[model samples]
Structure formats: structure tokens, C-alpha cells
Target chain A: MTTDLVVVLDADGRALRGRAPKLASEQLTAIYDAMVRSRVLDEGASELGPDELSHYEPTHGREAIDVGATFALQDSDWIVPRKHQPAALLARGVLFEELANAWLGKIEDPTMGRQLPGHYSFRSANFLSTSSTAGSHLSHAVGAGIGARARGDDTVFLTFCDVQGTSSNDFHAGLNLAAVHKAPVVFVVEHAPWEASERETASATIAAKGAAYGIPGVRVDGHDVLAVYRACREAVDRARRGDGPTLVEACTWLTDGDTPAWRCEDPIKRFEQHLAHQKLWDAAIGQRHFDTATAELAEAIALARTAGDPDTESLFDDVFMNLSPQLREQRRELARTATTTTIQP
Target chain B: MTATETRPGVKVMTMIEAISDALRTEMKNDDRVVVFGEDVGPKGGVFGATAGLHEEFGETRCFDTPLSECGIVGAGVGMAVYGMRPVAEIQFLDFIYPAFDQIVSEAAKMRYRSGGEYTCPMVIRSPYGGGIRGGHYHSQSSEAYFCHTPGLKVVIPSTPADAKGLLISSIRDEDPVMFLEPKKIYRHGKGEVPLGEHTVPLGRARIARAGTDVTLLAYGAMVPVCEAAADAAAEQGRSVEVVDLRTLVPLDEQTIVESVKKTGRCVVVYEAPKTCGYGAELAAILAEKCIEYLEGPVVRVAGFDTPFPYTLEHLYMPDEKRVLAGIDKTFAW
Candidate 1:
């Protein structure tokens, strides 16, 4: 309900001139460690894939928005992510190898090499597929919430979009439908206008758009993992209680704007500083988490490389529940000549 | 779950009534079955195809949605992915363009893109084709667009019985289905439909008439026109076989090839535009599989390549005489 930007930890990772939310040491450390792990995976993934597939949009400083918001929800809740967030997937219990499989476009992945890199889906974790279409996941999240409510389940659906994504028609229709039906959906908009220089043209607040749709809007400092978690937790609780949707706009930056130091604006460093202030983290703990993340990434990449590409005949599969006679014939024809390579004379 | 069991007895119903009965029957049997779209609840849809559903199943199961076709289809895809069999209604097929991205990109590809971990078990019901005197905005037969999508099942029912049966199968299928209703024949005739639990399998064609001279391949509203043309062909001492291709994606190619191979001549009838229409796919299949058995080139009796006209709709849509002329072309050649 508060339109003001909610900040718990300042840029120095120290408490600001306000009451900060309390959390258990383990919970705080877990959130911080997950953010660290995600940053490591992001760096590793950038260079892990083969050839042209190595390119990826690294989640350099948006760890808090991914890990923190996900930390607020339960395992039964659904996470509908538009962009790839390794932190969120890790928090949802997705294995590092599964992520590597998806990044490598291997058959072991849930999408079975059908999707491009970063378009992952883990049904066991209740994580929906990452849609490439901007703002389209908003309505799907709302519909998932509505469907769960109709089935008498209290599963909340959490979805995210960026400032530019708010301009899509689905954003308008999704929020309006969620509010009208009082669906259990929490929309999290990571407003980082600094990523795109042209994004500076629009000075409007993403949270303010929720007011026109009759939903409570709250803004939080995206760098502060605790602040994002608290705001998302409240929204999740509100949705679970059938009070309707809430839009939590987490304002963040891709890097330190005023200061040249990455530690000043890095979400993982800020959360680590907070943990240090709480006397729950130190260099040894940080090094151990970093080593674990690096080792896991190495193992995942190794296993992913061992896996072969999907079968050529699988190209015709999954187009429908059962392959029709037409696709069956196509699959047979593909298998016949798919292995033959023509050599130029 | 099981093969559709049709209990004894039948009730004479129109295509619209059959559609309503299908919705009611499926919603009654499966609590997960939901019927929704703009004006589908209280208004029972613009054509009354979903009439009495709201009263029968209440708002949760049967309700109206916002007027956004994209929202209706996209949300239905979400619901279906979440384990609900959503039978979403699009007032008219011409209005489905706004949801085309959702239909092709999201719903159709949900299962494939997700590697079967997630599936979209839903049916999108929409009235299609000309003869309703509607202008271009409301009368275009756009099923060809959906038929081109690999994962989507494009089904068109000509008779009331098939409308009810195919709809039931569509609802239970573990993939998305485009149940394009022929609004032109929504109430043209009443036929004896099974009382309850009658289901027709997808990807199968029905032989409307048996013949030995020429075969008329058609679907939806054109099925009746092809049959009537067969009667007219019989007067000229030529037996014309009419094949109703129920589902266009899987496309009863077996039956189509078999019929054409027997008849040695083929005429494809459709209400969509001639260029790149569904009839083109049919003719290609006939040429690919039955060319050796053919006696002449395949003729296509379809709507013009121009936009659907309001005032000149009767002239634009192919009638029985037009189909007969197509048959005569095959015989003359």
C-alpha cells in the first residue's frame, strides 16, 4: 500500500534511519549465499556454452530481485519468470545441471532442446516456462492464480517484468483481470531503467500503474535483498489470503552509477555486508559459498557436455500429444537421410 | 478417458444446440472442464452456442471474460497448463487474429516447448466462414492459419452430431484444439445426435456419400454443399464421393487418398480463399499420394482470394452449383 520507495539497508549495507525487518540468521545467510551462488553461475554460464550458444544476458547485479522475491514464496507457489533468473531457479531447488542442460540445449532439460537458451521450465519446482514474449507471462500468471483458486488451492503465482514490459497490452489486461477476479497473483516489476539508456525517456513509476488497476502498489530498493523479500512476502500473503493482486516495483541498477566500485551497488555484496553486520558471515563463509558454486557449475557443465543433442527424429515429436500419421512419416523420412552429409566436389 | 460411449437413443439437434449440449455434457462429467469467453456466461455467446451453461455450472466453471481475444486465449492457455480443460469461445474466427500470437506461440507450442512437462489441454471454439451475411470482419474462414501450426488440432464439423462428438473429443485431448464451428450451417438443418457421451475421434474423415466416378473433398459447411453437388452429379450419371475431413492438421490423408484413388478424379471444396487455403493442402496431398490413380487435374471450388464481402457474400461463397461445376471440370478433363 505504500507508494514510497522502501529501503532497509543503505548503499553501505548499513541500516537506514528506520526500523528494519528482522529475520533469522540462517534465513538471511541463505538468501545472501543464494545470491552469491547465482552470480557465480551467471559468470560461468556466460562462457560455458559452445560456440554461438555461449552468449547470454548475464544477471550480474539483479541477484536480489531474483533470489529475494523467490525467497518470499513457498514451494507450492508458482514462479512465472519472463527473463532467465538463475538465482530464482536455484532457490526453487532446480539443480545446477538442469540449468546447464537448458543453457546447453541438451535433451536432459525439461524443454528437451526445443527452447532457446534461458527459456527453462521445471514443473517439479512449480516454475513456469520463461516466455520470450514480453509482458505476456502476466496474463498467464493471473490465469494460473485464477485456475488454482477455482480448484480450491491456495497456490500463489509470482511473475516479473521490466519497465519496458509494462507497455505491453497484456500488462494492462492481466492486472485488470487479476484485480477484478481477486486472483492470487503477485506482479513484481524490476524497474532498472539504467540497463537501457533509452529507458530514461519514461519518467513514470511502474508501481503507480497498479493504482489504475485497483491493486496495491509498493516500491522497494532492489539492491537490498531483505527489502525486496519483505515487500514480496506481504504481496504473497495478500494474494494467498484472497485480498487480490499487489504490484511490487523493485527499483534497481545494473551497476554502481555514482561510485565506480562494483561492491557498492552489487546486490550480493550488499546482502553479504548486511550478513556481516549481523555477525553471520565472514570471508571464510563467502569463499566456501563461492567455491561450492564454482564446483557445482563445473560439474554441471561437464555433465551437460557428456549428454548428446536430442535425436533427429525427436524433431517431429511433442508437436502434439500423439504424433499423427503425417508426423510419423516425416520422422521416418528425417531419420533416413538426417545422418547423410553431402560433400562438395 | 475411454472411447466415447453413446448410449442408446438420439435427439434431433442443430449444430449450435449440439455444441451447447457438448459443453454441458463435458462440464457435467469433468469438474475441471471450464467454458468461458466474452458473453459466454449470461449472454450464452453471441450465437447462443453456450446457452444455459452459466445456469447449469455457475460462474466458476462457466463465465464471461473481458472482451480481449488475446486475453481470453492466453488466459485459457494458462488455465489449461494448470490442469484445467478450458473450452474458450471466440465470438467469430475473424476476430481471432488478435489472439493469433497466443494461439500459435503459446498454446500450440506449450507442450512441445516444455518437453511434455507442461501441456495445454484446451479447446478454442469459434464460429467461422461466410453465409452469415457478416462483413469481412466477421465472416473470414481463417482455419488455415491454425491448421498450419504443427501442434494445434484444427477440427471442423459439418453435421450436428459431429459438432457435439468432436467437441467432446477436443475437450479431452491432451493438446490444444481449434474447434471451428461453421456458423453458416449453425441452424441450417437438424440431425439426430446421440443423447449423451457421444465422442468422435480427431484426424478422421467421414464418407458423406459413396461414389465411383469422382471424389469431393470438403469440411465444415462445405460438406453439405459437396453432398448436394453429389446429388446433382448423380443426375448426370456420375457418382461423386464426398469426404468430410474432420480434423485438418492430422488430416485424414488415408481416407482422402483412398477415396481419390478409387474415384480417379478429385475436387476440393472450401469456403476460405483459394490461394494457400486448406484446399491447397488437400490438393497437394492428393497429388503427392494419389496422382498415379488420378484421371485429371484436381479442381478447387473455393471463395475468391478477395476479402469476404457483406452484400455479395452469396456470390463469394461456393454453392452447390459451383461445386457441381468443379465436378464437371474433372469429368470434362
Candidate 2:
């Protein structure tokens, strides 16, 4: 379940003597800020109305994998995040207001209230849309990698999935395609065994699945942001160099109480202790970041609430480049009978 | 960009060859166009529909994929949204089930789901319909599945010329198009195709034959069946106008309504099962729009509502006899 490749950071967040990936203090602080903001946003969303709460799934304990993997990529590279990994979009610079609008299905939402909450797609930011279906985006990552290579661009595609996603047929198909074509893709899986079953042990780690496709795989501690960052950065570098895909399994527990021993393994708590040991954290600094995140989310929620629902006409838009004659006729009929009241039929 | 070798005049080719020609021409015309599928590379595809593409376009532009339908389609969706006009071929329409999620949930919803911020301009070309005795696994007419999904353009060309033209247009389209190629006519159906730059815009139907008694509505493989039935009806002094619904989704409803209005009787024909088939939609449209013009109830000649059987393949499909029966019943009414 562990390997030499797992870059274990000490309790103080320092690498075992000069083994740390060289990240600037500001960059480390920014990563911490992103994690805090993501946590705050999720907490706020969890307390929303039942209509909104139904779509929001909290990525409470896995912010490190989301932030670290996303921050490792360049602006030109693509990130196909899982539905639970809104933190990846936050790390990629999606505006908090826009995310809130999308989450609330407001008129200003980029998706026009089509997708559910937490599913984000920012084309300008090179982040593909997330699908609710498990492991479906893996093939899309491979396709984007193929597209980059075809255009002679060195853009790597990074996608994240949970441990159970590795068992999906799409996961296998995507990895196999990447291997055969030598596509530049990095797959990051947040490994949690209990998500599959309580009786299921760590019998076969997700990292080993890469060998079937002749790609190298690594396992890292998901609790360590620097560890996840280093592993994902190396994979990204390899992909950029045309070395093909690398599957990195970030071993972390999805639940705070998955087991008594894992209760203390919260990624945010672990990183906070590391930052405090490195003389980079204090009660004031932590409070300032937490307070800023809370205020920003509150403002975003207020703004989202002010936005109107999508116009009835927008329902007919984006179905095609131009609506067909049949669609045009249908739209006319809908417009004629349109009402603000939801029909109970 | 290398220019596709153009012929001096019109060229006669089969539907499969016309499809291959369209792919080569589009790939040569636009660098963004990429074609890939199972056996499409060195093998030129199982039916030779993609013959010589790998050699002509090289492995990167044209290549083979693993035996995974979902991967093929999902990858195509990804490539498309990332700004590539990917043309993915599913070996057969029946095999497209594994990739149905990618088509319906991903490809079909990308643009609307992203609010037009992202568009998937991709073509999924799969051979459909049953006639070659390939049995259930290899033979199916599943165009209705895609036609039912919004944000997708479903096209099924009936002639070699229409195949070339509609495919060229589908490739150039800005939305995801499910180009269902009728495998029954892949080689059997031959016609004179335009030499170069021929494009048949989608959502348009072609009147294969002009008549006055009954309007015979068909598409894909059923076009030929309707044609033969029209000929048989002609022998009986019954004039049947045959309408080829080239693109089912954007459905040339105008043409269908006009044809039905001109010919007071209408008979729909298709190879899919009768219940909830595309014929049902056609019948409903006719009932709603052309009811007063109709001389009889909208009759349908279609496969029985059962699994495509091996021994009764002939009986399962709506052949010329069944189509004639539909025409006769309409005339009688």
C-alpha cells in the first residue's frame, strides 16, 4: 500500500532534510488560502435550501488533492475535475461570484442553469466540464491530451477520480488509449477504500492499474499538500515531455471518522500543523484567512441571490448553432403559453 | 493543406466509397478534421468505409482505437470540445450502446450544458439498419435513440450522393451530429456522386420519386424499400411519392407535410420496431399537421415489435412486400 515514491513529509511539513519541492512561501500561502476558501464555500452550500443542498456534495476532507493537482498545471493545460472537486476550479481562478451563480442556478450562470451545483466548466480557464457520472471524464482527458498532441501543443490534461472510479470501464479505456497513443495525460485518484465497501481492504491499489497500460503509477499521501503537488508536478512534467500518462493515487480517507486512527489525518489540519511548525502560521493569520473566505462566500451568495432565474427564451438557445425550423416552431409555441408558475402536470 | 484529387466530372461510387471520399476530402480541406475508430486505420475499417484514410492522413490524423466504444466516443467528445472536428466511427450502430452515455449525456449536452461556452462539433458515423443477415448484434436501426436526445443532429443518408454530401455537411456542422450510415447499402447502393465540394445541408429531405397517390416516407435503408414498393405500386397503377428523410432530428417536416398534402395518403416505412419507432413520430406529426390533407390514417410499415431474430430476419424487416402492403392499405382507406 506504500512505496518509496511516496514523498513523506515530517510533522513539521519540512521534507526529510532537503527533500521538499521548492515552493515559494507566497505560493504555499496561496495554496493554503485556496483550500480554506473551498472549505468555506462547501460549508456555506451545505446550509442552503433543500433544492440547492440536493446538488451540493461536500469535498470536505480532500482539498489537498484538489488544490495541489490543479495548481501544478499551466493555464494552457486542461483539468477535468470530478463533480466533488469544485476546489480545482477555485484553484484555477474561477471567480467566486460566478461559481455561486452557477451553484444557485441563477440567470447569470455560465451554464444557464443546465448543470447541477458543483459541476463547473470554464472553457477560457482550460477546465473541462465535470460530469455527474463516475469515471466518465477520464476518456475526455485522454481525448484532450490527444487533441493537444495533434495540434503540436505541449498542453497536458489532468483528470481526477475517486478510488472506485478505477474500476470503471472508462478508466481502463482512457488509460489504454493514452498508453497506445502516448498521450500526455495525468490521472489523479483520491483513494478511499471504504467508499467502495466497509469490508473492502486495500487489496489492489489504484496505482497498480497503470501497469496494464505500460504507464508509470505512484502513490502519495493525500494529507500532504506538498507531497501531492510534487507527484502531480512530476507527472505533468513527464506528460509535457511526451513521456505519456502517469497515474498518481493520492491515498486519503474521504470521511473524518472512517476509522479511529484516520480521524487525525484531515488534510487541512495536517497542513495547518505543518505551516505552524514552519513558522508560517499563527492564530491571527489563520483567523484572517478564514474570515476573508467566509466574507467572500457570503458576498457571493448575496450576489447570486440577486440574480434572476434564466430567461424562458434561453431554454431554446445553445441546442444548436442555430435553432432548426422545428425548434423555432416549438419555441414559438412555448413562448405563447409560457408562465412564471411551474405547472404541476 | 494537400488538395483532394478532384475528378473531371461526376464520379460513380457506392455509398461506402462516397463516405470514404467525403472523409478524405474533409481531412484534406481542414487540418482540424480527425477520423478514428476500430479497424479504421490500417484495416480501412471492417466495411472498408475508412479505406486508405490511415495511409493518406498518417497515424496521428487517422488511426485505430482500442475495442472500447465508450472510449472512442468519450474521447471524440473531449477532442471536439477542445477545438477539433473529430469524426469517430462506431463499427456498427448496435455496438454504440456501450458509448451511449458519452453520446447522450456528454456529446449531446456539452453545448447547452456549458451554455454555449463549449461546443462539441463531432461526427459519430456508424453503420446501421438490418438486411445483410448479420443478425441482432451486427444489425440495428437505432437512429431514434439519438433523434430523441436534444442538442444532437441525427442524419441518415439514403443515396451514395447523399452520403457524400450529407457527411461533408455533417463534418462542417457546428454541433454534434450522429451520422447513421445504412450498412445495408454500403456497397449495394451506387449512384453518381458530385466530383468535389458537394454538400447537402441537414434538416432537408429529398423526394426520390414524384407521384400523386400516396406519399411514401422513408430514410436510411428503408428509402430503397420504399422505392421498390413505389415501383410495385406503379405496376398496380398507384402513384406513390417517396420521401427520403435525410436528417431525422431537424426532420424536414415542411417537406413531409408538403408531400403529404400533395398526395392525400401517407405511408411511413422504417426497419426499426413498430412501437415507439421513428415512424410513430412521423405518424404523429402527420396527424397533427396534415390531418385534413390525409386521405387515410397514417399507416406505418416497420419491423415487428420484437428482438431482431436470426431465422426470421427477412420477415422481421419491412421489405418491399410490407411497404406495398402499407401503400395498398392506405389506398384502400
Candidate 3:
């Protein structure tokens, strides 16, 4: 399963000679900070609600893929997440307060409490709105690629999906269409085989599937943040140059990272060790980033908790560009019910 | 901009030609408008509704897509969200089921789900209805499916002129539009259409033939049948009115209600199945609003509750005769 994977950092956080990406000390620190913020938010959301955190805990080990791939993308590039990628969203400039509001479904939430905790739509940051249905956003990425090219810009589109997304119908349709149309898109799959067994997918790695669609596929160690960045940056560069799409498989696992072996695979600790090896890590700086992230998450959650629920009247908004006459009547009917509530008492 | 005003010249065209004219007019005016679907490029669509668009607009603006309806629609949603007005043809309404999720879930909900920051101002133009001997796979009127979904504007034009204008208006609309073209009347429904920049606003109905005794409501290909039935009813001294409801979602309820209240009778007609068909909604609206003005029960002249058949499509379709009978039911009541 580890065939031809581009590995930069080992399990012990030692960088392979000449394989690590050339990033400045600040850039490295920022990437590490984003990963820590993601981890903190993931843990902090548990205090928001256990029912919401249930969906966030199992997919915690793949923070490297989220932050690494996001760092490789430019500000103009669009991000279509197959599922929740809070680390990626945060790296793309989404505010922690907004993310917290979305999780709490507060009135100030940009989505107006329409979606679940992790189903985000931050258009200001070029993040596409996500849905609960799997594989639906794949073709949207391809379409965005075509659209960006059509606008006569070099903007690229990056999408993150799970390993099982390869088996969906939209996966084939999106890849084939992107290749056929030479769309500027990069498909990155966090290849954590949670559902598919080894016997079922043992014949070939998920990266090889790109060849059938006439696109190049590269496999990378998902836990190695630099490795994922290198692979995704190359793909992004190729796509922006009008070379069509490239599929990058960031291979990791779905785990809680509590056990000894799983702990070694922690993307955050591995990156901290790499920073310490480069004489860039210190106890004070590490504690500052962790505390800052924790405090930010706590403050955001606290503020979102104080906000009221979305106004009931806003439910009728955004159904169309303008509310039709029929909708106007319906809104009036809802208002009547609201006014009549006091009369009943 | 709304092109309610048009040039002086007018040209007689079939429904298909009017549709092509609308696409060409919009693409020429706005560079953001793109037309693509299966066989839409060099083949000019299976029904030639997109004829000469690829040659005129080039491959980037008007091109072909893979044989996946979901890909076609999903890509259109993406392009629209990226600030392009894409008109994606689904070949036929029957084949649109595969892309139904992309249509209802992605395209329709993009505006509301994104909190109005993102929108899918795209058009999904598909040929529908059970004429042309196309049977179930090629035919079948499925506008009711899209009409039921919120955030989507379902439009079915009855005349060639209305087709061009309505298609243009749908292209310019801010929400997702299900531009259901009647394949049955693609060529047969011919009339004088404006040369350029004509717009028939949505959520409005046209009085095809004014009368007093009864009001017959229909859209798309069925509008012509209702008109013919109204003409026949006129000869029998029945004075029937034919109302062409161009857009179904932001519905022209005022016009339909006014027409029904004036006539005191209503006959709803459609080519789809009778059970839970669009005609049922029309009947219910009439029953709710125009109940006191009604002189009879709201009769629906529609296809029987059966799959569209190859040989027996004639019996399955509600034609001039069936509509006339429906008119008689309103009179008898």
C-alpha cells in the first residue's frame, strides 16, 4: 500500500534529506499554528455538543492533509471539501468566530443555521458550499476549474475527498470530464481506508485510478505535512498551467491517535519535532500557539452561545432572488401566527 | 438587464429555432452565457435546438459534454457559482432523473444553502412531452418534479415567440431555471417571433384565446391543444378562454384566478400523468381561490396514470378531443 509514496518526514519527525519542501521558518510556524488551531477547534467543539463532536472526532488524524493542501493553494483558488475540513477552512482565512457560530447555529451564522455544524459555505474565501450527500461536489470542482479557465484567469480548484469517494459515480464523471475538457482542477483524497477492507482495495492504490482517466496521480504520506504540501503544490502548479487535473492521494488512517503507534502518526507532534530539529521550536512558542488557539476557540464558543437563534422570519429569505407574491402571503401567514401567540396566552 | 423591449423586425420561427435564437442572442450580448450538453456542439443537440451555436460561439462557449446527465448539471452548477450563466441541455426530460439530485440538491439549494452569497443562475433546457413517437425513454413530461422543488423556476413556453422570450428571461433570471422545452411542438409550434432582445417576464400568464364561458389552463405543448379546443368550443357557442401559464413556480396566480373567476369554470390540461400531476396543483389553486366563482368542478384533462407507451402514446396524451370533453365536464357541472 506504501508503493511510490513521496515521504518527506518520518514517523519520528525527522525530515528525509533533500525531500522536505523549502518553507521559511514563519511559513512553517504558520502551518503548525493552523494545524494546532484545527486540533483545538476539533477538541473544543466537544464542549459545544457531543452530538456534533461525534462526527468530528473520528476524522481527526488527517489535519496535515487539510492544512498542507490549503497552504499549497493560492487565495484565488476555490476549495470544494467533500466533507468538513475545519483546518483547511481556517487556513483559507475563515474566522474562528464564524466557524463557531456555524457549529452553534447562532443567528450570526453566515449559513443562517441552514446546515449542520461542519457543512460550511464561505464564498468570501472561495470555499464552495458543502452538502451531506457524498461525491456530489466532485463535478462542482471540475466545473469551477472550467469556469475559472473560461474567465481567462489561471485560477485552479482543489477538492478534498475521502478514500471511498473514488468509488462514487461523480468521481469517475468529474475526473473524466476534467481530463476531457482539460479543466484546471486538483483532486486530493485523504486515503484513510475506514470502510473498504484491504482485500477489497489491495490490487492497486487509489492513485493508480487517475491513469484510467488520463490524469497523473501521486501518492504521499498524509501524516507528513511537507510531503502532502509538495505533492499538492506540484499538482496545483500543473493545473494552473493548463495541464488539466492531477489526483494526489494523501494516505493516512482513521484513528483517535491515543495508542503508541497511532501517537507517532500524529501530524502535529511530528511537525513540532521537525521544527525543533531545525532549531525553530521552543517551549514558550509552542505553549503560546496552543494556548492562543484554545483561548480563541473558547471565546468564539462563548460568544456564539450568547447569541440568539436565527429570526423565524428569515426562514423565508433566499428561497429566490426575491420573494414571490405567494411567498409574501406565506410570510404574512407566519407573522399572523407569531402575533396570535400572545392572544392565546 | 431585463430585455422587455425588442427591435422592430420580427421573424417567423419554430419553437426549436426560437430557442436557438434566444441562446445566440444572449451569448452575443453577454460573454458569460455558455451552452453545453451531450451532442450540443457539432451535433447541435439531438433535436437541433442548439444548431450553429458551437460554430458561432466556438467550442468554449458552446461545446459537448460526456454522456452523464449528472456531470452536465453538476458542472453547470459549478460554472454558475463561478459567475457564468450556463444553459445545460439534458437531451430529454426522461434522462434527467440521473441528474435530479444535482438539480434539486445542488443547483436549487445553492442560493439558500449558501445564504445568498452563491447562486446557480443557470438553465437546464430539456425536451419533454410524449409526442414525436419517442416513447418513454425519449419522451415523458416531468416538469412537475422540478416545479415541486423550491429555489427553482419551472418555465414551459407554449408558442415560438414565447419560447424565445421566455428562454431569454430564464437565462437572465437570478435563480435556477428548469427550461422544459416541448419536444412534441419543437417544430410544429411555429409563429412570428421577435428578431432580438425580447423578454416575456416570468410568473405571468398569456391569454391565448379570450372567451367567457370557461377557462382552460395549460402550458408548453398542451397550450396549442387548449387553444384548438377553445376554438372548437367557440363554434358550439361555449366561449372558452385558453390561459398559457409560461412560468409555473413564481406562478401568475392572479391571472389564472381572474380568468377562472370571470369564466366561472376551469379545465386544467397537461401531458403528464393524472395522479399528482402539475394539473392537480392548478385544480387545487382554483378550488381554493376561485371556489365561489366556479360553475363546475375543476376538470383535469391529462395522460392516464400509466407509463408513456410507444404505440399507445396517442391514447395516453390529452389532445383537442380530450380537452373538449374536459370543457364539457365543466359545463355539465
Number of the top DockQ candidate: 2
In the range A1-345, model 2's lDDT, one tens digit per residue, is 344447647655666666678888888788888898888988888778977545777777788888988888888888887786778887877778988998888888888988888788777678787788878899999998898789888999999888667778899899999899889999998876347633433445677778878999888878788889999999999999999999998877423233423534667777777778777888899999999989988999898888899977788889998988877887778766877623221
Off by over 4 Å in 2: A3-5, A197-202, A254-263, A341-345, B1-7
Candidate 3: residue B229 Cα off by (Å): 0.9
Off by over 4 Å in 3: A50-59, A197-203, A254-264, A339-345, B1-8
Separately for all candidates shown, the number of backbone clashes (residues 3 or more apart, or on different chains) is 0, 0, 0
Question: Sort by lDDT, best first: what order?
Answer: 3, 2, 1
Among residues 3 or more apart in sequence or in different chains, the pairs in candidate 1 whose N, CA or C atoms overlap within 3 Å are: none
**What shift in Å separates residue A146 of candidate 2 from its native position after superposition?**
0.7
Query: Is 1 or 2 the stronger prediction by lDDT?
Result: 2
What clash pairs does model 3 have? none
Sorted by DockQ (best first), the order is 2, 3, 1
Candidate with the larger DockQ of 1 and 2? 2
For each candidate in the order shown, give its overall lDDT on alpha carbons: 0.85, 0.86, 0.86
* TM-score, candidate number 2: 0.95
Clashing pairs in 2: none
DockQ per candidate, 2 decimals? 0.71, 0.82, 0.78
